[model samples]
Target: MWFKNLQIFQLKDTENFSSTDLVTKLPDHPLRECGSQDEFTFGWLPLIRNSEQWSISSDLCMLVRAGKEEKVLPTAVVREELEAKVAEIELVEGRKVGRKEKADLKEELVFSLRPKAFAKRSDIWAYIDLKAKLLVLNSTNAGMTEQLFKLLQTTLGSFPMVPLQATVSPSSIMTDWLVKNDVPASLETGDEVEIQDASEDRAKIRFKSLEPLSEDVTRHLEQGMSVKNLALRWTDKMSFVLNDDLTLKKVKFDDTLKDNAFNDSQGGALSDMDANFALMSLTVRDFFESYKVWFEIQDED
Candidate 1:
């Protein structure tokens, strides 16, 4: 599947690591369904839906999936039940329910409800880019990404990675781009932009479907506000919103590229995935290379 968001990390000393090694180890820790009382569970899953393969590996990239299953026990429902029990006990016993007893009842209520509670499931897609030495995940959620990191570390014994840190602040550079109306030749500004004042008040402004270098955008830059997020098109092949923290949001590959991959697959599910992965990996690798140059990231730090 196409990645929609990016949380990129720099991986060090990966030249000698075998991508197949990671794939082989994934089966040792396949995702377990949540137990009756478990709040949540996380584990590996097949990269392709309904397929047995846990990973799709190539010399340049290895794609994998992690799944999270959680019980959806509503807090309000639990609180309502607890109150009813506490009231019944208080009335039946002709006494007030003690604090400790109330807490105990709530715990019992939650434990009883967990099994019947609806299960929520989601998947996180991540890939190891051997060419770029980057671990990119299609999630911006801190908790989800951390779970992936922890699982990888446990499964492989070592996952030496750190959040991508560039030599220059992205906001600062984006601000300069708007002020000068001089975007890098490889990238073209898109219609959406978010600017925020640096002052403590932190006033933020968002513009949609307008030129990023328009008079209004430049005027905001003139007012001491800097770019917090900006939508950008990369070499006419992909588009995404680049955040100040360097995370990518709203990522999308050009439809032409997607169409080509689909046509090349000749209409089989597994072949489709393979084609998409191959094209996506190559395109993203090129994007990352340009990103490093733009941000002056000479090497992983």
Candidate 2:
């Protein structure tokens, strides 16, 4: 993000002015625009010039054009031939070699520099949301897709014990399989069913029907919900089973869910979803683990 505002400029010299002369006069030039005291004190004019071709080589320094009468200063030298000159200047100034020097040196080489472009938060989030919608629309395997949907619901429900609900039409056998196998169901009387996990074994977990969130919930999420919020909501519903340990153990999404979600969204949102999910899980787990370790250390006598 900081790199976006960066600008580089190269120095231009007449036949009378040598590159060394330009470099020597750099400190006195008025174009220096360091953002902080550190930048001001440590920054240097980067110089770029060639003895052979002055025009093209001189075009290799950085320039910040703020206003009229603001003399251009060199930040770094791009020409390898000028290394000895650079070292000589450094030795003469008795300046220490460090990041500030490096930054200043880098600043000198370009003849012209402009800020880099960056995407806005709104634009990035909109892209992610659209990607999710596209994945849902294009999946070919209805059954697998349905299974994936239920898994998504189970893994990403509001309540850990209760699973999200959806309807399965008689015509949609694939949907029926997905609901029955991928999604856990608890029948009430006739056609009505709910999802719940079985307690026989922790390994053989099942889905449970969760009460649907009101419209207000969706509105609240849309207003300012972050990726962290969504991840936390989903992890809470999944009984905190998604973590680094679980990841390293070769745990994977339910096959039915994977088939459908991947088959449908693989070409779309689901393509890079797994890697993103893994990164998110690892990040959260590491943060919490570090906090816990700190807490334990603090509690030590």
Candidate 3:
């Protein structure tokens, strides 16, 4: 599946990574169903839709998925049940329930209700680009990404990586691009932008479906606002919102890219998947190579 957002990481010690290594280790942490009293469970899942293969390699890129299962117990329902129990106890004893006793009652009630709670499962996709020495995840949330990193580390025995950061802040470069209307030739500015004040007030202004370089936007730039997020189209291949933290949000590939991949597929499901992944990974590789210079990404020795 195509990733809708991007969280990039620079993979150190990439020489030690291989598809075989990941495939061998994935079984150690296969996704398990949540237990009755367990709040959540985290583990690995097969990357392909109908295949047991946990790793798919295409054009030097390898894809894997992390699965999470969480119990869903509505807070309102728990509160209602707890209140009814507390009320019944007060009526029977003709006295108010103590705070400690009420806490214990809520705990007992939750444990009892845990088995009936619905379970929700979600899959997170990620890929490792061997050529680029990059690990890209389909998530922008720090906590969720950290969970994946932890799982990978535990499974593989070692996962040396760090979040990608530029020598100059992304916001600083984005702000300059907006102020000068001199974005890189390979990239085009889109209609949406978010600007925030550098001062302590931290006021933010969001503009969507409007000209990002219009006079209104210029006025904000003149008044000490800087670009915190900017929408960008990457050489007619894909579009995404580039954030100050270097995460990409709302990433969408062009129909032509999808069409080409489809046309190249061999009419088999597995062939179709391989073709799609090959195209996506190659396109992303080109995109990173095109813009990484601006970010001044340093290679690990």
Deviation from native of the Cα of residue 33 in model 2, angstroms: 19
lDDT of 1: 0.89
Q: Lowest summed lDDT over 10 consecutive residues: which window, candidate 2?
A: 122-131
* Cα RMSD to the true fold for all candidates: 2.1, 26.4, 1.9
Better of 1 and 3 by TM-score: 3
Q: Which of the predicted structures, 1 or 2, would earn the higher TM-score when compared with the native?
A: 1
Shift in Å, residue 128, candidate 1: 0.8
lDDT of 3 at 59: 76
lDDT tens per residue, model 2, 1-301? 0011101111122222233443343344322333322111112222121122111111222121111112223334244524654687679998756766655655554322212211111000000011111111112233433433343233223111111111322213212322233222321111111222223542221222322132333233234321110111122111121111111111222344344445544453323343333333333333333323321312111
Alpha-carbon lDDT, every model:
0.89, 0.25, 0.88
Give candidate 3's whole-model lDDT: 0.88
- Badly placed stretches (over 4 Å) of model 1 are 86-105
- Runs of candidate 2 with Cα error greater than 4 angstroms are 1-265, 269-271, 294-301
Q: Give the number of colliding residue pairs in candidate 2.
A: 40
Kindly give the number of clashing pairs for every candidate: 0, 40, 0
